[model samples]
Target chain A: MISKASQSFQVASPSVADQARLRLAPVIRIALLLAASVIMLAPIAFAVATSLRLPAESFSLPPRWLPLPPDWSNYKMVFQQVPLKSYIGNSAFVTLSIVIGQLITSALSGYAFGRLQFPGRNVLFWLVLATLMIPLQATIIPVFVLISKLHLADTLASLILPALSTAFGTFLMRQYFMQIPNEFEDAALLDGANQWQIFFNIYLPLAKTGLAVLAILTFNAYWNEFLRPLIFLKSIDKFTLPLGLVNLQGYMGTGSISVVLAGVVISLLPVLAVYLVGQRYLIEGIMMGGLKG
Target chain B: MSVQAREHPASARRPRLFAKLTEPSLAGMARRKAAMGYLFILPTVLGIVIFTAGPVLASFGLSFFEWNVIDSPKWVGLQNYDHFVHDSRALNSFVTTGKFVLLAVTLQIFLSLLLAIGVQATRSKILRYFFRAAFFLPLLTSAASIAIVLAYMFHQDFGVINYYLGKIGIAHIPWLNSSGWALITIVLTYVWQQIGFTFIIFLGGLAGIPADVQDAADLDGATGWRRMWDITIPMLSPTLLFAAVIGVIGALQVFAEPFVMTNGGPGDATRTVVMVMYESAFSFLQIGYGSAIAVVLFVAILVVTAIQFRLSRSWVFYQ
Candidate 1:
């Protein structure tokens, strides 16, 4: 069916035939990727959908793909039925404090490791990295003891204070700082700037990307943190979102699928918002942070 | 130097300033550097020592004594160890954790590698970005939310999964309720959440691979499975080993998903060692017993990591 010139072209560079044969490849690959993505995202979508559906609409025989009349009441009910606002406030307070504290501590430590020359620098850096391998379960019991002994148990401070320093955060900032040129620091030093001024003015400006990444990561970790809150926070008033959601399960008891889904939706909003706003930085930061540490 | 300085006023001024800066004393500069270094590092050092290192050492010491929060510590050297060795519940948990690790890590690594290959084989940026976001979305979702949603999704009746099964004329399966299937459900959830991470790691490794090596393989008449086995796999070995080790460590400490989803349920079928330790410490108020289990888990992780490092030298090709 081909013309002579075209046939010669195909024969000369059989890659043409190969490309023709591989024309179906992209379609197939796209389909597979789409299918996998759906599988990955299905639960999240279902949570969102179920949250928007009424109690009767949620358990239909042929499950409703879309709610007939979108029920905004579930959102109202979540706030009314649970102490959702207090939990949100508590989570926000703990997460913000921890993020700020961790950033300051990590930046200081990272700059020390990256730029400063001092005795035992290598040894100290190695020690910090060593903590990354120690699983949290290994220290949970003692942490609980320490918290209780200090009478910080049943308070938000227990949640915030213990997480003020992380090995991964230090490692992330150090890697970021190392990428910056020394000329800027030298110039600052020659201009009679002290070390703190150099760090704040020179290093921090260059480390905006690192700080954004750390903020997103720290927020995510702190938001969903359950064990620490569960162990430390005894009162219902002090509970964070995760504990609130779990306690919501107890109130619903059984077959209150709509209410539970509503709670899940409430918990997910902040994280999803953070992700949508900081998507690019989140991905890049994860790639850099995860690979190094 | 003097002749050059004479030719440029700027050079002469710079030397004079440098001389003034350096003339204070060498010892003074040393003292300043030491003070600055400590000032910079003080917060982190104090935080680690008080928060991290203190708890770790306390845990080690607490493992030797029996104490509830309300009671005085009674010295029980190796009694908790003896109890751990003979306890059927502890043994079951150990086995369950091991099984979860083996199944979860194996499937996670395999699926992620396949995803990486699929992503690499494609040239369309749109499709690749879609898959990247899709896989990475679960990583963003909180484990607590995932557990709640998945628990509903796997509901025995009126669940989407069962609806599909009924449409296909198959019987409903109790995913979280049956002892046999409960652990598998948790394992699948673990894989679902973790595939994004493994896929990302693989993608990072894939980007590091040179395009010419793949092109040369194609020129040498390698195609499909041959190309993958001979060229791709060998080149990606370092990433594979890294993923494997991380997967192992993560799997061994698996807690949140199972904790939220099944609560180590259907009659202890999914009781992980961490869950056991958690119960021992908090529920039973047996600090000494929990500490012993924690110590055992630590040693196990160390051994596994050491073995992985040893084994990696032979097969992991770093370029």
Candidate 2:
């Protein structure tokens, strides 16, 4: 409930001064937030604008914010000059593979940790928690060599294999599974369902929200991964979206910036599409990731 | 632990001796369940062992040897470490990263917090979602793409940013070329790309605060800045710590932004530790030296993270 003072402040008998201050507060707050959002949106807006600008106009003075006759040719030129299709396909394959692998691994492990009983459960859980702080960079060099030793380098396996599981995904799943009421598990046991059957039938179906969150979050990450692909993949045709776009930038270094912007637009399309499709899960995952830990 | 606690009641319902002697099958069932638990966790455990811990040990081993991929490694104990201590470029990279983290993380945390607070002021759901999407959209973008777009915008002669400054009667700033300005340009892009993620985290943090706490503060007549500083900040400290830790750890791994935008540029102005590792191992093929840098980076991250946690206790609060 609102405080008595706040209720009084809102009363019909309020003075002109109180009403003026009251009316101005939210307005100022809204204006400030709107201004900040405009700044945040500016880079993306500029990329799209430049992508549509005439190649020559990109170099013009007081650089144009709106491209008249909206040059669609730059995107076509990007397609011609760089293989956008292969990049997208490779990205999609690697990202999807990782998401699937992570889901299976995380779900099984999370179920084990959250519900199943075993010796050393607490110790194992701590190990999982500790891995959350281990940045991939710390271990990249040897993992690179490991991939090479396995003759997996330059293939999509190099990109997808090492990331097949993540501690964060496991931890997220475990926390969610922990919240499931024990009655479900007890009833399943009473029905004579074995561990795997109970997990697959009862727990997995009940964990749709957690699974959706993990998939969406993992997609955002592996889709944008640059360093791993940059290190692991060698061939141009094999490049993921970010790697291919950077390679294209080098080739287009002496050319107009509009073409690069066009490539940038293409690269961002899937991410934006995914976000629009699953904004709820993506947003919730960020909040869920932070506050839970 | 809670799951373990549930086992006690079940155990207590059985006659202990009979449960053990007559129900040998129960013991078998428990062993089977334990095996299942192990089976469930096997893949993730293997992942950690092979990909995480194994690489760390390999890095420590490789740091002592001088090896390129083309030749067999020759052990040169402490040479890379010796060179690292005197390497001006490596030292400068640390300084560059430090300056950046100091600037960018500070700005990111406070700006996102302020922006979140501003957004929270509104009651309109549509407006809130619009603003949320605007802020969060960049977190979905690759650093390479962001660097490409911003590089063009910060282009010295033909860049839109310079053109705008010129419109306002200010001299053009050499954003990526100048040693002084290049790191700032990198910092700006980092903040722009990442602040939104931090904003959402802060929004979550603020939203997580129980409504009654705010009502209580209001009843006590703690309005405006006093309420925020006294009430909101204390409550939000855990989120603040989280954002700060994440920001610092990520900043320590800075590579792609400088790599894509400036290529650690005009005079190594924006080169980071990872860039050094990258150029050494890949460009120069000095695997040993690169591994040494990687080891140093790993240690640096660990130490910095530890310090951040140690300091967080003074500020971060829990319910």
Candidate 3:
């Protein structure tokens, strides 16, 4: 059902030469697309290859495309050098908490805004939209102060607490809930089902895709989040994957290029796993959010 | 009056399912429904108030006072705002940020658009999916990880990139060591990870263009660039605007790339506004000045976004 954008930019003319060139256009486009893909993936492949090399071999001229015999020492060295396990655990815990928190808050509010009629529904939604424009960087100073005042500084809870609610997630779910037909709700209403009942039984079950999209996006975001953890968390044990990675690179005096690259590759695995499984949802979320905006 | 008789007027429009309840109970049910609506939205509203709205206002207030977290905040009135007049580093940081946004957003939009168009032009469905997935692969990794890898790859002395260039008889160029190349390297690192986002968005927009439009363009002998410029672009302008606006907003707040790649260094060459804010508040403990910087960035984002929308009115077409 998708249409091509007529990429052959040369003007169409009734000439054999032009027609021959037109026939060659797709081949050229494919070759270009192949190049783009290689460019896009090369850095990551390089990271993996570099991760398996020795310190001396890391900077070797005419860099080896492949690390033959695939040195496992660097991977072991990363764990020895840093509290890599704790970093991963902290990331997973914080990410899961934020995802669960956003799901609940977004779903409930989305249902309210989409299905239920209340006095200030429109105003509240506009307020939510306004929140989307204010990035964390703009408000982080006060957030940091507030967190510290609550004695949450240098804690993972500071990261999880501030990010538990997302304007983007709420808006996304609202769009999903709005798309569902009213007939289902009306039928449930005629059966004497309460709002809670209708929400749990009728709407929620139908909102699986929206929920999945929210969960996957939330997971991806917080799992890789660097800024919040960088600002809030202080102790090395409480550091997330991103922080640990930056730390690894920062201490590169003692750390080898191979070990640092190994840390980078290791940190990417969880996000990579989630992405591979929920790629469709991630794509759907981006398209849906983009089109709506 | 009898309960049913008196309630008959109010309950006349009600369904038979609710016929058994009295007028007061019906009123209570309506009240309960409203409360349920409020209840459902309570957590989100509370979060916004506590985390977003409250902090935003507090940040604005904090901009007016000098506080370093160790002592109580003192009122300085317009002093914090006045610092920007003489603060060369602050001004330079803003200028650097402006340069960064311009370079990153332009390259990102142009490359993603070209790639999206290329992917859309492919006749093979499997290859199209493969290309789209490949382009998006970088986005799956953390920016910290990407920057770390690139920092090594772009190293002047030992980088793989320079190694290859050396093989071709070109001298080793400083990627992160020099001011000029540092910013470009940061942009490249940022765009490499971020292009997938705009690529997917453009792909979605391309998919939405009706086949009939292309067919109609073909009938008029409008092929290739002519069709893209005249018909496809106009139709895709809405999505293009969306991608650009979002792209600009994101580019304006870039932190991780500069943070990990260069740490705002080789003389603050790639330092972003957020980096200044982060360093001021966290590193230097100048919370008030940091708050002022944040407030300015917030206003700049709002104004820029507004301008994008205002300008889009001229070119963005709706089908």
Candidate 4:
């Protein structure tokens, strides 16, 4: 026991020490993660902090980590300097209409593909899927021309109508609907309900998760949309949130940093609210879509 | 309900009798199905035709002719394609776009994977939710707002980044003004905005992995580094590949940030291919030339995607 074997045993025990390593591993990993999280969150937190600071303090030599006397007036000035309220209103109106339109169109089409029987349904569904491969940039010029010809340019209609139908939304809904048992609809049909009634009553309720996901995605897309609005809407009164923020640049320059920061904060609040409310559904929806891809 | 039964009895009776009359023929049922199906999908079909397919074909046709919105089209016959193929600006745009995509996608996928794994190890539900929300904050904010805030933050003289650099005793770098740094700043911004999405996808992928496999590996003297390398990485390859593909596609279309932040400036270092297409179509009114560039970009995406799929066969182990 007190021979050469004792030396090897001691070294082996140190190498094979599971309890110490296992206990230390997760703690170290979590600490590193927490540090990383702080780095990831710092800039956004700073942005929020700067928005609340006085304009002079925003760019102080040793930048203020937190404001002394928070200049809440920066938000007030943002509203006064730009048509921030109108922009928010327009964004909400357009985003809501687009989401509603997409919901109706996608649900109907998804039901058709998932449940209904027809000639060439597969072909049509595949055709819709094929459209997703084409980038939006390639179609923007023609879309611009089409909007101009319809005399919808410079109107919110241009923003709302074109985005009301998406292949991704339809596909997502179809996949979700297909997962639902047909027995529910069969039961409704046996009770003398018509197809439309069955869809509205049975299918729609069952597809709540899909609908929530679609609504969140549609709202996010419309809210963050920039190029289409930039090209189509000419009037400042009609500009959406993104366009308004872009125009805010002209007024603020580098001098009014606090006001600009306030614009960022103001613009993000609605989206943040939506994300918080629908976080669960959004995570599920994105995961579903990513898996198929 | 009683009023409908009484008033529309004849209409309902007729439909019932008619259905009985047509019950023998499968052709009638098939026709009914076809009609209902067409009715159900009509709106979506019409929307796609007018909005998506029509525009795609129209863009293709427009790519062969020269026309500003104010003037009639003039047939250019491959001239646009020739100009795009030989143009210096077009070449520079391709190079810049390539660099941005390579840098942004690689860094984004790597960081997201790391963050996702870290998130998986955490047991505190509150902290998990908080970190997830923090990561997703950038995605919810409008690109225009983020660009505005980041531009200020990256400002050379009075910006916070430079202020910190001075504190650390490093010389102030022109983050957006210099050509070399402008593209890198844009890339960093793109990565920051996109990492959350990648992280979420990886988290979803991580949750799908079986826990027993890890336990088996642990019992077999495979713990920590060996366990992760032998088990986790191989199992997570599908998610990695998916992220890589989407990340590359998104990176190639890097327009909004560069457009808002640098205007593709400081000698066009941040001028992505899409930015070039935007400028040509809108700024120069060269629709044909712009379309040609877009076509090239589209094909490049196809090739890159195809390459990814091909390479995925080797590394992507679907467990």
Candidate 5:
């Protein structure tokens, strides 16, 4: 399944030394992979390292690469000095609600487009795809106006309502539903199931994989979302994790880098946990989207 | 394409069921299902109408008027567009944005392609999964969090980057303070967070290539560079096109990294068009002008998408 291109370049000779060199090639490759991993993991690892240090070590000229006697108090300050707990709660509420909302809409619309015979199905789906053509940036200004007009600004509703608008989710579910054999729905209908019954009983049950994919992607996207929340939420109590961390950075006055970094580590915990745990599914979901594209 | 997939064997089966159900209520049953379909689609359609389509139309109308958040909009006509032509800051922001997009997206594709190839060519399951998870770790972290840590890590004095530079007998580089280096720093920050995405996509693309193709190439004595260029690359063209379109579109709209890192500082050197739009509408309260900028950006993106579609007809290889 795997071969090193450069090392395998001259494969004509069948000498013992050539075979030995071939055996040694993966050693060099693995070493290089480790080097790449260090570069890739440096920023986050450094953040974790900085977050663990006492304030005394933060200002070291060389900036201690390793935090000796990892200051556990920094984690405490993450809560005591800032509203990190509430910020996390707000982020979770927003992310979860958005995920639930998207799952419902995407599943329904995806089922409609993928299975149900309706007039203008193709045209309507194309209209949905047209939304992807224009940037969200263009639509945001007016959406902000509309939100403020409805007196929803400075509230989590502003974030959640617009967050629920997703063409990609529908697209993903439609593709998945299309791939499932139609016999499931047909057999259900033949058993006296109505279209709605077949949809709920037959289609939705078999769509666990699609729902999982949409849920994971939706959660990750909303949890990391910044620009919308930054514009929407006004009060300190209402700020999401991303907004709160940036605010914490500014509020720490550059003297408490350790505490600020602690806030970052705290903010990362939930999403990081989700990503690490559901990585296999999330990677597959992402790849599915890519291959279709 | 899905058109063929949508019209598979099950399609031929559908008419038989319809023919068997030739009751007088057949049309009524079909009508009921159609209504049910409408019911299922109402929420998404409503969202599309209210949030996406409505806002877009309103934005165009809003572009004709100058309004602060509190006051009524005053009509400005084409003055905003006229001013856009003369606005050096807006023009320069595009220049900076284009530069960042070119640097960041190009490097992202190159590094991600290399990483994907490397990750795919490794035999160990532990190594493959580890590399995938490690590289993708940053993507799960919020852009703001990444930016703050990166901004500190690139600090002129006590930054870890400079610390490493000194250890390697190199001079200190002004990563965030200088205008020239600031955008590059922002690009690097973005690349760090985003490369994993492209890498995963490319990895999927690479894995999609059949195993026997490699064996066939080996049999033909086209094992290494020759195989990659002549066979692998052509086969991966679809993924390459997909990644390029996504990368360029994403890179074009870069806001958070630059917004948090430089705040478009050192005399507007790192200012992106979206950041400018954001700053104008929110900070400067030039809603009309902001809308005009948004319109320009929309047109630019539309043109780019159209060009990509036209080019993909020729470039994207389908199995």
Candidate 6:
């Protein structure tokens, strides 16, 4: 077969320089990748190392690469200096609320836009897409005033209320719903299942991966959200982890460097945990943002 | 117009008389489906109208009026815009933002592309996975926390970075202390945290390049840099554009890094447009000016994004 012949036919042998380059390329690539990984992981490793060292040993002439017999006192000091627990709790509540809210709103709208045919559907989807261009920083002024008017200023509700719905989440879920086979819907309809029944029982169950992607992405985003909390929440008691971490760093002049690093470590743990568990979903979802329209 | 409602095979197989009997109920069912569709979208529509679209319009309106939360808004059409023109600090902030966006986005894209190519070239799966995960690790941490950690590490005296450099016989670099290096440090810190997203995107794009095209390039004696530049780069242009667009948009709104690390200090070195907006609206209590700045930023983003698309036509390959 022509195809087999073509597959078997190798490119003409190269000169010595070309052969040398070919043999050296992968080694060079691996070295570069290894070097890049070291650069990426170095900061966090240093942070962890610094957090375990004493204040006196923190900035020694030659930095300690490893903190032997690691001190847990710096982490304890982080707790004493800041309300790390309250910050974690507040962040968890707000992030979970937003995640649940977005799932409901995005899923329902996504199902409708993806499956159900109606007048103005394309126009409505375009409207949603347009909002993606409007940066939150551009709109926060009015949002601030709106929150103030609602007498929700300085409350966690201000943080939670506006973020409960996301244009991006809707788009993501709509794409996900569109990928599901239409045959399932048709089959369910023939089985006499109403629209709500079909959605809840069949399609919703099948959309677990999509929902997980949305939830994880949303959690990572809002948990790390600083601008909204910085602008809205005035009280320290109402502070989220990011705001709290920044506040802790403000005490860098008085407190030990180890304590501040400890605080940083504490704030990142939950996100690290989520990432370790759901990395496949997170990476795929992020890739989807670029690869898909 | 609606999609044609799919007919059941049983209905299609039925006699014309029976089909006629079912046609009225099928119309009723279609109407109910439409109603359900509207109902499903109601919450999302209401939320968007209230939160996103309404705020956009309101911010535009507020740009024409001065309000400082405690007092009534006084209409002053064109006043904020005029002030913005004369405000050197605001203009300077935009310039700083431009510089940051240029340096950070370019490095972010270039580095991530190299990393993606490296990861893709690896023969060992475990090494590939390790590299991918390691690069993306920092993205899991908040910008605030990362900035906190980096601020300490980049300290001029008694910091780890300077300590290491000193060992290499290099003098201590004033990373965050001086205005010259502040923006660069911010760029480095930001790229460290944000490059993961773009790296993953480029990896996805790299995976999509066809094997036959690569083999053809190889047969043409295009190996190493030549192959990457002539074949790989052209094929990956669409993803590069996406990464560049997203990167620019994000870098333009650089806030948390500068806000936490430098507080836009050392004489407005790292002060970004969004930082200016935040200060005017919150710290300085100049709501109208902040809104005006916000409007300018919004327009800047729209224009920049539009320009990227327009320019991309010459370079971006569809396939």
lDDT string for model 4 (A1-293, tens) is: 11221111111124546556555666666666667677667667778899898877778777777776787989999899988889999999999999999898989888888888897999999999888777777788888888999999999999888888878888988988999998997687568666667778898889988898998887887888887887789999999988888788856788787887888887788888888799887778767653111
| Most accurate candidate by DockQ | 3
Compose the digit string of candidate 5's lDDT tens values, residues A1-293. Answer: 12343444434346799778667766766776677788889988888888898866765666666787788888997899878789989999999999999999999999988888789889999999778766778889999989998999899889999878578888888988898998886687678776767888888988878888889888888888888888778899999998998888875757778788888888788878888678877887877652111
- Candidate 2's residue-wise lDDT over A146-204, tens digit each? 89989999999998888887788888899889889989978987776766677899999
Better of 2 and 5 by DockQ: 5
When superposed on Cα atoms, how far off is each prediction in RMSD? Answer: 6.4, 6.4, 4.3, 5.7, 6.5, 6.4
Local error of candidate 5 at A177, Å? 1.5
Per-residue lDDT of candidate 1, residues A156-263 (tens digit): 998888889877888888888999999997798678676667878999889888888888888887888777787788898899998888778755754667777888
What i-RMS does each candidate reach, in Å? 7.0, 5.6, 3.6, 7.8, 3.5, 6.8
Pairs that clash in candidate 1: none
Best model number under TM-score: 3
Measured against the true two-chain complex, the DockQ scores of the candidates, in the order shown, are 0.34, 0.42, 0.54, 0.39, 0.50, 0.41
Q: Cα deviation in Å at residue A157, candidate 3?
A: 0.8
lDDT of 6 by residue, B131-187 (tens): 989989888788887898888888998778898898899999999989999999999
Relative to the real complex, the DockQ score for model 1 comes to 0.34
Instruction: Give me the chain B TM-score of candidate 4.
Output: 0.90
Runs in model 1 deviating more than 4 A are: A1-21, A288-293, B1-27
Ranking the candidates on DockQ from highest down gives 3, 5, 2, 6, 4, 1
Off by over 4 Å in 2: A1-19, A290-293, B1-25
Evaluate candidate 1 and give its CAPRI docking class based on DockQ. acceptable
Local error of candidate 4 at residue B220 (angstroms):
2.1
Better of 3 and 5 by DockQ: 3
- Judged by DockQ cut-offs, the docking class of candidate 6 is acceptable
Model 6 steric clash pairs: none
